[model samples]
Target: MRSRPVLVYDGDCAFCSSCVAFVERRIRPRCDTTPWQFADLAALGVVQQRAAYEVLWVTPDGRVRGGAQAVARLLLNAGGVWAVPGALLTLPPLRWIAHGLYRLVADHRDRMPGGTPACALPAARPPGPPGGS
Candidate 1:
């Protein structure tokens, strides 16, 4: 139960759960995953809107990464064949390509029988203006 980086995932997604299970069992020194809803992203100083849409990796220092780079970072931390791809994805020229591929997969996750994947959380209703205006 050592404190480490946190992985935010969609708990309702079967694929996401499987991925988290992979990390929990395969990654030595095991990082923890928090359901996107329970982690208190804002309290953790994470930008909830940005992180909720895709995979996120929050390092111990509080920095965050999204898209394929996030997956690569986790892989890098996991220490194995993963490191090779992680190193490749982080390369500047290739980084955008990596993100693009990630976006494509994310865009159609539900079609894969992965679960009822849906885009975007519900819109937040802005609080009533100052003084109940």
Candidate 2:
């Protein structure tokens, strides 16, 4: 297993890329930040469908956190001054609100700064018969 955690995000979304860049530059997290498009999801035990929905934080011990939780984990891992805010954000009321806000931003990311129409998620596949079509 690797020594550092992995921050997995969407490569097709420009807004996501910008956010990743900001974290890399400002937070300087002690982890490897990678786009899902280039990540070996199977090795990470991450599903493609879930990854399409939100950013993921995969711990070295094989733990996985998504969305707001993932963001908090990343910030916490950065250590020092950032740890306080990260800890606060993961608490009660703020945690609930943070999750909601994370969902809102993720759902409408195509309209956010640095995002384009192409940033929208692809249509999900419809369920089929148990065995095969």
TM-score of each: 0.76, 0.90
lDDT of 1 by residue, 1-133 (tens): 2258787876766766676777787664246678787778875556655555677888877877877878888878876776887788899778989888877666655655544545323432222344655
Q: Please, what's the RMSD in Å of model 2?
A: 3.6
Q: Looking at candidate 2, what is the lDDT of residue 45? A: 84
For model 2, the superposed segments whose C-alpha errors exceed 4 Å read 123-133
Most accurate candidate by lDDT = 2
Candidate lDDT (C-alpha), each: 0.70, 0.89
- Compared with the true structure, model 2 gives a TM-score of 0.90
lDDT, candidate 2, 10-56, per-residue tens: 99999999999999999999999999999999889888877888899
Model 1: lDDT to the true structure: 0.70
lDDT of 2 at 76: 96
> Which run of 10 residues does model 2 get worst, by summed lDDT?
123-132
